[model samples]
Structure formats: C-alpha cells, structure tokens
Target: MNTISVQEADFDVGAEIEALSAGRCDVGAVASFVGLVRADTLAGGGDEVSAMTLEHYPGMTEKSLEAIVAEADGRWRLLGTRVIHRFGRLVPGERIVFVGVASSHRGDAFAACEFIMDYLKTRAPFWKKEDTPAGGRWVDAREADDSAAARWAK
Candidate 1:
C-alpha cells in the first residue's frame, strides 16, 4: 500500500512494519526507513523548527509513490512494499515518512528500501513549510535530491 495522510496524529513505525510483513512466510528480510522533522535545515539560519506543514497534490502524490515502489519491485525480488507519508502540520520529532520493503533476502530488501527513498525524495510531489521563530518558510527542493534519484535511471 502506498498511503499519503494529512493528519495531526503520530505514526508508529514498528506497527507499520509489522503490518507490512504480516503472514508473509516468503519474506526473509524487511528493511525500513523513517524520516523525522529535524530542528534545522541545511541553510543553518532558521530558528528551531517548532512545526512543519506538509502539502501535496492528493491523487498525484499517491500515484507518484506507487510508481516508485513499482520500480523497486521490478528491480528487486520484492515480496511486498509499503510507503506511508504524512502531511499537514506536524510538531518536532514527528514521523514524516515510512518506507518498508520485504524480500526473500537481505540484499534485496536493503537495496529496495534505499531505492524507494531516493526516488521519493525527488519524484514525490510533497512540499514542506516550516514554522520558525523567524516565521514560516517553504523548504526548497534540493538539487542533491534530484541527483540521488537520477542514479536509478535506465
């Protein structure tokens, strides 16, 4: 399942992974990645980021994530995959993204997880606005993110 939620609630990473791998005997490995709201950006000039509001094009966002996951499935021996990304206003220490990959071996699981994350960072249509003491600012898309995604090119 590829899910994009815009809620003020918290997500449990352990629960998500368990659900993704449930009852799958063929899955010998599971790799997961969680992204959190950091207090600072790379610019290093903002106040403590007290909260962040994530926005994305609804239908388009899920489609983009599904495509990324599909690419991973095609490239690896994946048994299953789940990606959950949250939008809306979120406080510090809140979970931003969850990526889980299940495969028959450790190598496939690890590679698929990294591939999904790298693709999402650039291809996904999510944007973040951070609340700081200086005020709110929209985080710009990073060039490095594009470069990361490019490594998976055909």
Candidate 2:
C-alpha cells in the first residue's frame, strides 16, 4: 500500500517499514530516509536552534507529496511507498520527515527512496520557522538542495 500522511505527531520508523512490506514476499529490498531537526543553525548565525515550527497549506501539501511518490512509482518497479511529514512545533532530534520505498531489487528501492527525498526537499509546500537564540527566522531554500533535486531531472 502507498501511504502519505502529514501530521503534527511523531511516527515510528520501524512500524512504518513493517507495515509497508508485511506479507509481501516479493519485496526483497527496502530503503528509507528520515529527516530531523538540528540543534544548530546551518544559516551561519552561530546560534543554537531551540525549536522549530512547520506550516503547510493542508490539501496542497498532501497533493504535492503524493505526486512526488507517483513520479517515483512511474520511474521504478516499486512494491510500496510511504511518506510521512510532520508539522507544528518540534525540538531538536525530532523527526521531521520519513520516506520509505519497497522494491524487488535493491537498486530500484534505493533510487526511489533518494528520488522522493530529493523532490521533497525542493517541491514540497512546507515552510519552516526556527527558534534560535538570535530570534525566529524563516529557513531559506538552499542552493545545494536545488542542485540535488536537479540531478534527478535528467
């Protein structure tokens, strides 16, 4: 089953993976990625990030994530895919996003997992505001993320 959930609560990675591949003998490989909130700011502020708040446009966010997964499904022979993105207030070490893909082959599963995360970094409609010692600041889109996503365009 393909699942896409956007919630404020944290999720269990093991449970998600188990659910994705349960009773599926054909799934030989499973790849997953989990994104977390960092305690330090990467924006060169030299300040500690205490927490962060994520916001999204509800319906649009889910649609965009589903589209990304569909694109991956079109590209690979995937058995199943699951994407979960968390919003609202969160502290460092908390998970922000999770992407998992199951496939018959390792290569397809790895590539699909990476592809979904790359697109999520650039295409998702989520916004983040970090609470740092310096003050609250909106996280800017990084050129590195754009470049990473662009590589999969080919």
Candidate 3:
C-alpha cells in the first residue's frame, strides 16, 4: 500500500506510520522522515521566520507525489509507503512533510524512506514563500537537494 496526501492540515506521524503497516507481520522495519520548517537563513528564515507559506497546484501536487512514491517502490523492496505534505502558513519548527516506508529489513526501509523524501524535495511541484524580518521571499531550489535526488537516477 502507498498513500500520498497534500493538504494544509497537519498530520499525526504515529497514526500515519501505524496505518501504513497496520496488521502486517511481514513488516520488520518501518522508517520515517519528518521535514520541518527550519530557522536556516538560506531557507528565508533570516534571523527568525514569522511564518512560511507553501503552495501547490491542486491536482498536480498529489500526482507528482504519487509518482515519486512509485519510483521508490520500484527501486526498493518496500511493503508500504506514506507521504504527507502540508501547505499553508506555518511557523518555524512546524512539520512540513512526512515520508514513511515499511519493509522486511531496515536497509530497505531506510533507503526507500530517504529516496522518497529526496525525490519529494526536488521533484514535487510545491512552492514556498517565507516571511522573515526581511519580508517575504520565494524559496529557490537548492543544489544540494538536486544532487541528492540525482544520485538515485536510473
């Protein structure tokens, strides 16, 4: 099972992970990643981020996330995966995204979880605008994110 969601409301990680592998004895390991709005200056947080607004095209965002998860399923031996991304005005330290993967082994779970998040950071069609002391500014694609996603190229 693979679940992909894009919304403004926050999610419960424990619930999401549990649902991914619920009643599955074959799942030996479950790895998850939660992305948060950081205070990093490069992310437009300047000294402090009063708020961050994330936006995405209605239907396109969900489809893009689905494709990223499908790619991870093809690359790794995964039992299930969950991807939840939030869009709206968020404060620093607020959860922004979550990627959870379940598998028979820790390696597959970890790798698939990371691969899904890497692709999500680079390929997802979501845009961000941060509100800082310097005012609002749109975030740019970081080379590091691109490089991370590139390493898994088939």
TM-score of each model, paired residue for residue: 0.90, 0.96, 0.93
lDDT of 1 by residue, 1-154 (tens): 4444434467788987887778767878989999998877445664678889998888898888888887888899988788888888888888998888888899999999999999999888889999988788899888998898888898
| lDDT string, candidate 2, 1-154, tens digits | 7899999999999999888789869999999999999897565667889999999989999999999999999999999999999999999999999999999999999999999999998998999999987789998899999999999986
Q: What lDDT score goes with residue 78 in model 1?
A: 85
- Predicted structure with the largest lDDT when compared to the true one: 2
RMSD of each candidate? 2.1, 1.3, 2.0
lDDT of 3 at 94: 94
TM value for model 3: 0.93
Clashing pairs in 2: none
Ranking the candidates on TM-score from highest down gives 2, 3, 1
Q: Which candidate is the best by TM-score?
A: 2
Alpha-carbon lDDT, every model: 0.83, 0.93, 0.88
Candidate 3: stretches off by over 4 Å:
42-46
lDDT of 2 at 58: 91
lDDT of 3 by residue, 31-73 (tens): 9999999765654333576789998888989998988888888
